[model samples]
Target: MTGNAALTTPESTAPQSPPEEPSVTVSGSPGETRRRAGALLALARFETRELLFQVQILLFFALDLVYVVLQMTLQEGMDDYPVLNQVDRATQPEPLLFAIAVLVCVNAAVLRSRKHGTTQQFDVLAMEPWRRTVAHVLSVVPYAALTALLVAAEYLWEALKPGAIGHGSLGELAIAPLTIMLAGIAGVLLARLVPSGFAPLVFVIAFYMAMVVASDAAAEGKWWGWLSPLVFPAYFPGDPVPADLLGRPAGWHAVYLLGLCAVLACVALLRSGGRTRAVKVVTAVALATTAAGVVGQLPHDKAALEAARRAASETPEKVQSCTEYDGSKYCSFPEWSGVRDDWSAVVDRVQSLAGGKAATTALTVRQRIDTSGGVEADTYIEPATTPGQVTVGTRWGGNRVPEFAVGVATVLVTGTEKSVLQDMCDARMVTIMWLVLGNDPSPAKTFQNVRLDDSTEGSGLLLTPTDGIGMTANQSTVVNELLERPHAEVAARVKEHWTELTSAATTTAQAARLLGVEQPKEAEKCGE
Candidate 1:
């Protein structure tokens, strides 16, 4: 009866079942994966918008504008079209500036939760820690896009200007965006370790200074200098950009930079919570491997860099297009054929002025626009046509006929110098002046302390003229006397003695005597 009463009690009366076992299932599915990816992208977009609103972005634009202004100011006196130079100078500071900007932006974004005392809130969210870190790194894409647009605009503006010469290709243009992304990723990884607001700024500044120093050193061919992002090939005024400057080093550098970004991202990912020790160790090893790969891909020696440049510049398909005029072969790159007509006219005039000596010289004249947008010429007595023929070359900054004429004259008389070399140089200058002025003695009225007869102390020829003052009183007097005579007579005398006048043995005094003009003596001391 007692057992029957116990069975009817509350414990027995309540219906009881077997204890429920917790279901074990996969943590994520396809849909959940998509949702996580979408969340990361959304976070990246949000961070990008926040970054754009910062006052420092405006400061960045201002600094870039200042750089452009400074370049424009400095290019005023340059003889070549300033477009390429302006672009070069304007973009010269890009890597450093963008790196600093991205570093600051990424640091602020990565440390936002901590700075705002929302770490606990962030911890409570179901999102994976690595995804959050990746989102911050992905924010660099938007910044890079905006920067690329601004850079394109700058280049487009230059391209639209009259006489503008565009420099760099689309591939070269990718440098800035890539550099920005690398810097931002690196900054985020650094923030994961340092976590202080000002620390990243200090790091970026120090990095920029180091890059500046390293780039300067790289210009001198130090292999380690190539480690800096700022070490790019540049074209200065009067110097042509080498065809090899945009070659394999660039591609290798891109790979190295991307590998470094990956290593940093992996390191940052490992810093987050919930990663197992095994996962951490595996990631650490990956980071080391990638870092080694980045280093290995770099140009370890100057010779390797040079070889890459040579390969990039090589144009095996380019063939010389030739036109015969006055028994000479005038050859040029096919793309440069547009200047052939003008060059032909100049060659004919020079040959006429030089008379029979040039007619029999079997000259081969080749013209090309060098990588730096400068006019360069190679003139030689063709070996197949003439033995002991001279080879001469000249590079000039502009495309004017006068410059080409001077180059031709300089080439023709290159190796014929004698004891009276200074006198011959003065005579050559006078001859060039006559060809340039073409019976316009009126231009000589604007004269100053022109010292035409003096030789430069070193190997270079002295051709000094400031502003409109290109001649001294003595030079002006001699030029006027020569101009007053009949043009036909002067032409005859020059043609008759062309070879002797170009020879080093012939002094200015001798040439003047041959032309039946009295040579002017040096002016008496001013105070004597």
Candidate 2:
């Protein structure tokens, strides 16, 4: 009776273990897994929206637009210099802006929870740490996409503009987005590895400096230059990149960048979450694979590039497609035969100036297509009694007045003595200008359209006394006086003693004397 009574009493009621806490299983079912995934996606979308509306991002867009407009303006200003335009477009503002945006946005996203002291709260949730890291990284995708779209739009606008030469290929278009994504991944990994808030910015700035060094090295054709994603070959006004340089190497460069991005991503993933043995092993294997990919993408030896250029320059099979005029054989690549007529006309005019003396020289003229898609004229003259063998190639585009003048000057000066006197050079330049414009004294008709300008001080002083050469004001006065005479008279005087006049030893005053023109008493001060 006493034991039964005690059992019924509260104190004796079997000190019951606290109601078995109902086995709160934190492990989730499939539905819970799906819900967490949905939640992560929602979080990513929210973060992306926040990034898109940030004041910095909006300013970046405005600056990008300004850059494009500036580029367009500069393009118009440099229309005569195609190489400058290509270089300007290649190094445009898009790449720098994209990189900066990725670094800023990704760093902010990865550090958001920590900045707000919410990391521990997030850790208590059913979601894994690695999954959260991935969501934050994925949030950068829209920004990268937006950057790519902006780049594409700029390129499209450039292509649509009148006289616009497209800058890069379809493959190059991928470089911007790929580089941005790589920056984001790198930012995330840096955030995980470094405790300081400014770690990512420091790393990005350091990387930019490294890229500048790599770019300089790449210009020297070093293999390590390829390590920098921003290093790309620039095509100048008349120098185009070779087809080989643009082909397989481009693909390899893209792969190299992508592999770097993959490596950073895998390292970030391993460092963020559980760090399970399997994750470590997988990360190790991935690191090795990507490292190999990067090593394989290094550029081949510089000799390979030289060999390719040699191959491209070898003489073609169809040497018979040549035009002959005035003892000169003008031949071009079969595809470029259409330009022969224009070249022949210029040659005819030069021959007329020589008065049949040029016909005695055996000249072989060949047209070469430079890497920049411009035509170049290579002229070779066989050794003769007048001069030794002569070979000259045009520096700029072919068949233009400057090129023609250069060709004629090469013939005129080849057999003559060489001198570097300012007056002599000025005299020869004036003679060449006369030949280029015939009897026309119009400045616009001359090579490069060089002209004399009056100074702003209204002192009756002229600017550019001798143009690019050392043409003194006195020499310019003599040239103008000579041009005002009868065309036949001037041509006769020039042709009579062409050898003496073209000789570099002949000074401008001497030439003027020979042409029966009186020199000015004093030289006019240039830009007075």
Candidate 3:
């Protein structure tokens, strides 16, 4: 009896580990939370691996990579001198292919259990359906990360080049990865909402059509355009405005994309039965953040931009930095200092073939960009009314080189771009074209590039980088014949007949005969 009593005593009892605390799972306990997190991470890793193996995902990623490489290496123009700020946007379109792949793949991944008739089976697992939805959303992160790496690599490809100029924006750089995230999250949300196998295809087509329509407004910098995930800026490649003049709200736009991604993720979780207080709070916060970002990205006062533009155009000296290269004053935007040498080389070549007062005249090569009508607007840039000054555009190399060469010759032949703009249809055109093309290795090609029409003996418009001049048929005939002669011999004759050749009253026949070139019968049929 004493032994049984002692065994029955509470302290002396086996204690049985207090019945294991009834094996209760306290809701939101630390250990339980950690276990759920671990399960989520594991499931996400599995999904990411599955996505990596998809043929469509791999194919589109390869295509994006190839497109980026080709644009970097094979595209025409003076890409060696890339504007660093704009280089970040170069990869914006590249990720469209990869993002669509993610969209299709992530959508299929979310719908896999349904398609396989295993949705009920997955419900028996420790992780809830909302957690599974969260996992699906997390799975897209790795692909987004890969896209970020690709964008960074492309940017470095341009930034590392020896001639890259200007400063790149981190805000601008964030666009591609955020775009990928937006696409991937959108896929998960779509699958949860629609649950149809064809939903992704229909979604893609509809989304594409909407973006195509919104692109025109986006390209025009409309406020509503920022509603789109990818906004096309109002500037062309290799023709960017100064960093301060860009006026793009890239920082706010990045914030907008982040908010959009969060909103999509929360809605997807809610659709999958995540109706807890925490998720609801997150959803509210994300919506507010998105609204704030949208408000921040709206177009601001244009008065300041217009005032700045007028200052840049009317009195460029105040805004430009001056550098002396080879006896010429090159006034350009601060970022354009590196390109001054290239401009100076063209100027020296044009001036080398000139005679009389033109040969020794010092020139001012001012860089001009017209952002008044918008960065992408092909607005007419007025010729420099200032004497001894010539206009050079933000573009250089290829046809731009010879066109700029024409501007230099016009400034040399006449006092200012004003004189050339006044329809200088005289014998002076013969002398001007010679000065422009005499030293060119391919004079005929340069001539064709500088003119609107390809005809060798007809009236045509001569192109300049900033403006144009009219060329009479007689003037065209004389200039074309002179190009066929040895450059040195023609240059000597030009110097000997400089006065008559430059005079407004000199006839085309007199100019041609004096230069010892055959007078085309077409010269006699011209008006003056």
Q: Which candidate achieves the best lDDT against the true structure?
A: 3
Model 2 C-alpha RMSD to native: 8.7
TM-score of each: 0.64, 0.65, 0.86
Candidate 2: 10-residue stretch with minimal lDDT: 458-467
Q: Order the candidates by lDDT, highest first — what do you get?
A: 3, 2, 1
Q: The CA-based lDDT of model 1 is what?
A: 0.54
TM-score of 3: 0.86
RMSD, model 3, all Cα superposed?
A: 4.3
Kindly list the per-residue Cα lDDT of model 3 for residues 1-528, writing each as its tens digit. Answer: 999776686666645553344577797999989988999999999999999999989999998888877877796556777788778876787789889999999999999989999988986787888988898899999888988898898899888977777778888889899999999999999999999979889988998887766766866757787788887655455356777777678889889999999999999999999999999999999999999989998888867867777787667788999888767899898887888888888989889988898888889999887766777456778888889898987766677888888889888887788886666666778888998889988888778878888656688888886677887877888898998887778899998888898887987788888888997675344333
lDDT agreement of model 3 with the native? 0.83
RMSD of each: 8.2, 8.7, 4.3
C-alpha lDDT score of every prediction, in listed order: 0.54, 0.57, 0.83
Candidates 1 and 2 compared: the better one by lDDT is 2
- Evaluate residue 514 in candidate 1 and report its C-alpha lDDT on the 0 to 100 scale: 72
Residue 480 in candidate 1, Cα distance off native in Å: 7.6
Give the least accurate 10-residue stretch of model 3, judged by summed lDDT.
519-528
